[model samples]
Target: MLLKDHVVLITGAGSGLGLGVAQYCKAQGAAVIVTDIATDKIQSLASEFDEQDLLLSCDVTKIADLERCKDAIVQKYARLDAVIGAQGVFDGNLPIQGMSTQHLDQLFDELFNINVKGYLLTAHIFADLLKQSQGALVLTTSTAAYAADGGGAVYTATKGAIRSLIQQLAFEFAPEIRVNGVAPAAIGNSQLKGPKALNLDHQKQSDIPKDAFLNLFQSISLLQELPNAEDYGALYAFLASKQNKVMTGQTLVADQGLLNRAVLTQSH
Candidate 1:
């Protein structure tokens, strides 16, 4: 009952971490609205939840599309309690020199638009409602914010920017709304792996020389085991709950011990 009677909206809820959070929120008694661009997947996931009334198909990169989603949810629930921004894309691994300028430019542009601008749009549209409810905004950032080669250069930049955005927005939105973020370590269940997701199979064939990406994590992470997408849900739930009142403008790193190992290595 951490989110009892609350109305929570989560973007990128079709699959991966977003869907995991949506399910967790629903189980906690929140009236949850799950949204993603993939209509069929959203519908499929919604069927499992038994509450499609709160499901929406949204493309967070587009302000107007997201507005439509917000409007629909408001019409049904009349109030907004919390929002979790988790929609993002990663084109696996390609060295900076191997990556095409066109690919890099387009990917970074879209990445920032979705990862950063999407948060801005959601905050703007939902700020008033969240202010009224004294709700929280939980954004998803990655451990790439701290490590250069954790992901692609562009991917790293986008996550790092999101971390900074969370801090600034927390200050600007002040006592009315609470904003926080989670910076996870290499998550095992990624959309970046499959054909329908980041489509890494074809990507590896095209630009990247390696057969598989994400090998760098093994060497750097002391824990050796990568976290699953579902493993991150509890952190978001905690940040979204009233239990986290005094913790705003902050970030939690769920890296399974990679960061500490990195720090120790640097000191040595």
Candidate 2:
């Protein structure tokens, strides 16, 4: 009941972390509005939630669609207590050398469109409502934000931009609203290993060298299990809760201490 009586609007709610958060919020007593571009996926997902009161078709990359999503939430709930901008994409693992300018440009545009631009637009559109509720924004960045080659040129930049955006939003929004982000390690749910539209298994011939990935896991410490989308829901819930009022403009690392090990001494 951490979020009891609150209204949370989440993007990318069709699947993965977004879907998980929506459900978590609903379970915690929040009226949830789940929005995603994939209508069919979201509809199917909605069935799983059994909360007919939550769900919308929002393409975060499209301003009109985002506006519609926001309007729907305001109409139904009157105000938003929290917003989670979780619509993002990792279009397979392509290295800088292997990537064409066209590929990089297109991917960069799309990633920022959903990740950075989406967050900005959602914040602006919901800021007034959030101010009324003293709400917060929980953005989903990633471990990729901290490393130059964590994802790829495009993904890294997009995540980094999101990291900065969290701080900026927290500063601009001030005491009325809080802003924060979570940086997770590789969650093993990326569409990167799949087809052309990230639907097929392309991991067999991924552009990122296998050794680079192996080295990352080999050096990791803490829990051995792979991180999952559902694991993020609780963290998101906490950040969006009233208990976290003093915590803002910070990025929480929930990667099983992956980054901590990165900088830790071997002796430790």
Candidate 3:
């Protein structure tokens, strides 16, 4: 009941981590608004939500789509308490040396547009609604932003940009709206698609063998247990709720101690 009586919006709720967070938000009693670029993915989520929730097709990079969603939220709930941006793309972890100059340019815009700009646009569009309610805004980053080799160069750069965006946004929106970010590592059941620039859009991270992923995670992670997307919901819920007053302008590293362990192992 952390979000009881609250109205929350979640972007990129089609599948994987975003989908899990949306469900958890609903269970916490928030009138959740779920949106995704994939209409079919959102349609499948309809039954899981009651009338108290809304489902929409949205591309976070598009202002018109977001404006439409805002109108819908106003028509239904009248106010927005929080906005959680979970939309992103992975860069397939291809090394810089492996990529051509042409591929790099294409990937740069593609990943930045979706990974970084999407959050930026959504935050800007929804800022008024959040300020009106004195609510929160939570954007997703990644551990790649903090340490090397967390992802390929382009993907890591995009995530790093988000980390900075959170701080700047919190400063600008202060005394009215709180802004923060979460940087997760090794999320389980992530269907996180790769970049279309690299012709990897048709593939998903989850296509990797479960055992292989788990084994790799265990070797480098101190927790040694891969957390399901829902396991991260409690943190998101709190950050996206009125109960959070002490935290703002920060990105919580929800890496299951992977980075901590990585630093130690690499030091040896």
On TM-score, the candidate that comes out on top is 3
Question: Which has the higher TM-score value, candidate number 2 or candidate number 3?
Answer: 3
Please list the C-alpha lDDT of all candidates, in the order they appear: 0.77, 0.75, 0.92
> What are the per-residue Cα lDDT tens digits for candidate 1 across 1-268?
8877778898888877888788888888888888988798787874667653487888887888888987897788888889999887664645657766766676667667777888888888889989988889999998889866667777788899999999999998889888999998766556543122233533322233222424555666666555667778888988888677789999998887777665545532
Candidate 1 lDDT at 115 equals 74
RMSD to true structure for each model, in Å = 4.1, 3.9, 1.5
Best-first order by lDDT:
3, 1, 2
Residue 177 deviation, candidate 3, in Å? Answer: 0.3
The predicted structure with the larger lDDT, 1 or 2, is 1
**On residues 11-86, what C-alpha lDDT tens digit does candidate 2 reach at each position?**
8877767777778888887888888877887768655665436788877767788788778777787888898877
Candidate 2, lDDT over the whole model: 0.75
Instruction: Report the C-alpha lDDT of model 3 over 129-233, residue by residue, as the tens digit.
Output: 899999999999999998888889999999999999999999999989999989989888897999999999999989999999999888877887799889889
Best-fitting candidate, scored by lDDT: 3
List candidate 1 stretches off by more than 4 Å. Answer: 193-219, 262-268
List TM-scores for all candidates, in order: 0.86, 0.85, 0.97
Q: For model 2, what is the alpha-carbon lDDT of residue 37?
A: 76
* lDDT, model 3, position 220: 79
